[model samples]
Target chain A: MESWEILLQQVINGVSLGAMYALLALGFTMVYGIIELINFAHFNIFMVGSFIAMWVMQLMGFTGQSHVLYGLPLTAMLVFVLCVTMVATGVLGALIERFGLRALRGVSGTAPMITTIGLSYILFNVILLGAGADTKNYSNPMPNIRWEFGDAVLHLRELILWGVSLVLMLALHYFVRRTKMGKAMQATAQDQEAARMVGVDVDRVVIITFFIGSALAGAAGVIFGLYYNYTNFGIGYTAGLRAFTAAVLGGIGNIPGAMLGGVLIGLIESLGGQYLAVRWTDVIIFSILVLVLVFRPTGLLGRASPTKS
Target chain B: MPISDAPQTQSQRRPPLLEFNDVNTYYGELHVLKGVNYRVGDGEIVCLLGGNASGKSTTMKTILGIVRPKSGVVTYAGKPIDRLPTAERVRRGIAPVPEARRLFPRMTVLENLEMGAFTRTDTDEIEADKERVFGLFPRVKERLTQLAGTLSGGEQQMVAMGRALMARPKLLCMDEPSMGLSPAFVEQVFDIIQAINKQGTSIFMVEQNANMALSIADYGYVLQTGEVVLQGSAQSLRDNEMVQQAYLGEMKAQ
Candidate 1:
């Protein structure tokens, strides 16, 4: 491929990948924002979503067959499968808040973070034991369609991913800025006691935050599985770590910052891997994170005040 | 002015709205409130006057249940509340407008007021209380939708007081409401304090402005080194030689 063509392809690839990371980072950022704890189990929840989607599709007998419903063309029945998975994952996130995080409230910061890390490992192992170590294939295969614009090409799956992620981000922004619950979330994020003082059910708001963040991650997992057509038990740890890094880069606890950081990180990884060696991607990305932290500990947008402080 | 017209109950017979008996508090191992005792009767404005680190704020915190008193009893309405959490205390009609006017900076003035009644379940009652607060402080109404952080210091103090009133507390505890206000605003705040008391909310206030506090207080306690050294009715405390010299300025003989 020509340099310009390759660079354009890299940009497209970066954005598609970045959108997935953004979804993951949003979950990490939201949970961390209200509680000031790193929810290590979030990534595992994402993996669970992917598995759930796979199981749902298998049960529905959705094997890449197109169908017509209400005069509309449906590519695959797996859309419903993905939706169910997202909701299930959302509920799981809420359960974690109710059971795991709630008990650790007012405890030392290190204790909760360690607990989450432990839970993440436990979840990873449980999935490994149940689902086995082999990579699972989804029932809905990625459609191999490419639109050519001059010498450049756009994959259909990439276009769909970008479009859906952008819409999700916009909806999130609107929710946070406009809706009552969203405003309560912002208030809670800013000052939990103050929010509680205002008659906001602080506990309810925290749980809702977990659900929304997790749903986004779950949706991303389904999209990722559909795009790549494969999933494994151990995918969450690395992806979760990267998403967390993205969150820090954009400023942890800041909503828009998470998206921005995610996209920037994706660009760096894709472009760096293309220009240099693919294996050097993590090193380059981490080095940039180090530089950004040294210069601005707050991240690109700046850190919101942590709840306790 | 209405103080004289109200039926005079046996001058010494009314039960105290709040009573603290030999309360002791600590942060880690450092004892803050050392056997502190105080009481405020219904409709009375009691001032806890002390210089820096005399445990004025800590006293207020203990009453508000922010600082857990290790020993002794704090009773409100004849029920012990030393063990209740701060939120529960606020629910039970004890509200504190903390020092420095800890307003929610990002929230609008109206939102901050609403937060004061967080424990209230009746929407209509809360709305009515908000209107009452607005009526009490017109400035707050004027800046209802403005972010509290953008308000002037005096305005922030008004919002803080208004927020506490929204709770409809029986015993309103104010910690240094005049700490960082202008001299004019300080006078206004003190006057508001009197008006609030007249409205039937007994007040337990901590103040560094001893002279002004004593002038307005029905009863006053002078604290030094976390202990009350002198206490009496306001008029009597105002007449004592040491109080006159140290706090009240030279007495004018009739």
Candidate 2:
């Protein structure tokens, strides 16, 4: 294969990975934007989503990719698993907000943020004890079919990952931009006092934001399992950071920016891993984050702190 | 002429749409409102005037329950509202045009206006209210698709007022409607406030623009430190020696 072909292959690989990161990043940006909480646990929510999807697939009697699902049956099973995983994770995220953070709403900024750190640790340990610390295999339903174009090959799972993420992101964008509830969410995010004065039930909006964000993270987890075919307890720690980086890169709190940042981060990871080792990906990502913070703290799409605030 | 300088007599004269009874509020350990007692009568444009940190804004906040008072009762309509949340107060028909016209900068003007009527579920009336808001501020209609933050200061104020009106407010509370505006816009805003008052919406506003506020308001309250120093009809307050020396004494715009 030519050098550019190899780059293209890396690009495809990066986008598929980035799609998952973007979803997680969106959750981070949105939750941060509204409440000013870093929600460290959101990362593990994605991790939990992956674990749930795998367990559900196993429960449904699908074990391995050797006798992989095909056509309608495959599509049906995937849809069922995806919906279940999204709801379960979404509810879990909402519950964390309701029981964990709701009581601490006005108790200074640091309190809730520290609680999120505690929650992240709780989730990490729960999965570690329940599912073990070892990297487990994901039961991928789709057959790993490769499509070649001019010496470059793309996997079917990659397309599904990209397609599903794009559709969900678009749906989320529409829900926020066009719907009345979406406008209320934006109002609450922009000015909580103003939103309340206008009679918006801001608590409900926060709950909804958590649900949507966590649901997207759940979808990303399913796709991550489908694409990488591996899972572990500690994945959220790294992947969540990557998504957070993507959110910042795209301009934290910016919806479209999160998508762009996610893809860009993915590309950088894939390309960097291709040239340098995979171990260097974190160093490069964090270095870029540092540079972005120093030079343009608002980020590529972040116009100013005003918009985020 | 309609009411007396004493707050006790004023409440008996007209059924108070909103009342504060010895309301004391604090932030952290610092006491803000000492003992604020005031009444906004039905269909009255009442203004609270004070210098910076005089607890004028806190009074508005307490009425809206943005900040709960450490002690005392706030009654709206006929019920005790000190315990109600801001959203609940808003549901009971209290709306605020907050300090600095805090429009959702990222949302479009239309979206911001839509948020104003968030409490209302009647779609037909919401559409009608949107039309009413458009009628009140034609410029807001022209910039429906424009991001609210990008609007001019005067236009943003208009949108803010329009947003407040969308709530179909029985009591419209404004905090510093003239805070950041050109002289021309301040007059325009005051005129619109009076016009809204003529439409039968009771207004309770906190302002530093003493002269403009007195001109349109039916009643006025002056706060110094954290207590109501004077309370009466706009005419009497404007005529009082203390109010003139303190608030209207200087013929200057804030």
Candidate 3:
């Protein structure tokens, strides 16, 4: 492969990886945006989402061959799995907010942060006990067809992953911009008291924020499992750290910032791994984070003031 | 006697649009509103006057259900609204221009207006109300796409008032509309307050600027240390010797 082709390949790989991170980063940014809580459990939600998808796939007897179920083909079944995973994860996210975080309302900021960390631990343990400690293989049913531009090969799976992430991002943008409920979400994020005074049901807004943010994370989890071909109870820790880094890199409270930051981090990880040793990829990512904190503390797109809504 | 049970004075016979009957509110152990009684009639502007820490804003919050009264009935249009949620009270046509014109700092003026009409489902009416708000504050129309925080103080106040009007509220509650404004802007704000009142929107305002508040209010209540010290027609409060010395900044021979 030519040097340019290698660069292009790395770019493609980075974007695909970034798309996964973007999914998780959005959850972090959104939860932080609404309530200023760094919800550690969000990462666990993503891990659980992937596990749920794997279990569903196994129970349904889905394999590499396209099989029809309920007049739906293999692709449709995948969509079904996606929907189920998203809803389950969304509900889990909402329940965590209701029982864990909401109960800590009006308490010191440290309380909710610590509670989420505890929730993450509980979720990790629950999955560990239920699924066992071994890493479960997540089979990719999609045909492994690759399109080549010169020496840079693009897999069909990468295209689907990128396409879905883009579509979800666009849908989220439309929801936040055009929909009434979305506006209410933004308003509630801006000022809960003012939002209430203006007739916004702030409690409902917080619940919906968790639902959407977690659903996105769930989608990411399913995609991560399908791409990486494995699921484990402990994936949430490393994955959540990277996504949280992306959120901070892009400016924690800003939506577009999180998206951009995730993609950038993905590109850096891929290219850094290609150029340097694969083991040094995390060191490289954290180095970039330290640089950002020291130089431009608000991240690339975040404003100095915490007013993104 | 329960203030709600007291018969309306003969001169003002219409049932009160909003009646705060002997409200007592506390923030933990700190008593904030003590035996407060006042009423705002339909299409009337009732201004609550006090210095800082006099529980004027707390009284506004009590009516909107943010600060629940320990005892007393807060009745809106003869129906008790003390138990209603803050959003529920706002949905029932009570809107507030809160202190410092708390516009969503990051949102565009247009989006802020959208938030004001959050409780309403009638799309056509909401659109019409937006137009009415624009008419009331043309500066807001010009700054529709501008982020609210970037606006000048006077312009922000316009957006805040425009946001409140977008609700098409029956009774508009304002907390210190004249706070942190130039003298000229204060005058302009007061003028707009009267103009809004003329359009059949009753106003319940809390302010320290007794001179401007009393000028536009139909009735007035003087609060001191969480208790109603005096209440009467706006004209009477403006001329009262005690009110003149304390609030109106007017002094006669000591």
Query: What TM-score against the true chain A does chain A of each candidate get?
Result: 0.92, 0.96, 0.94
TM for candidate 1 is: 0.82
Give the TM-scores of the predictions, in the order they appear: 0.82, 0.94, 0.95
Native contacts recovered, in order, as a fraction for each?
0.16, 0.72, 0.67
lDDT by residue for model 1 (A12-68), tens: 888888999999999999988888888998989888888888777767665543421
TM-score of the A chain in model 1: 0.92
Docking class of 2: medium
lDDT for A268 (candidate 3) = 90
Give lDDT for model 1: 0.81
Number of the predicted model whose DockQ against the real structure is largest: 2
Which residues of candidate 3, in runs, are more than 4 Å off? A63-74, A304-309, B1-13, B250-254
Residue B209 in candidate 3 has what lDDT?
Answer: 83
- The true-structure Cα RMSD of candidate 3 reads 3.1
DockQ for each candidate? 0.24, 0.57, 0.55
How displaced is residue A77 in candidate 1, in Å? 6.4
Stretch of 10 with least lDDT, candidate 3 chain A: A63-72
lDDT of 3 by residue, A27-111 (tens): 9999888888998999899999999998888788864335324323656877888899999999999999998889887788598
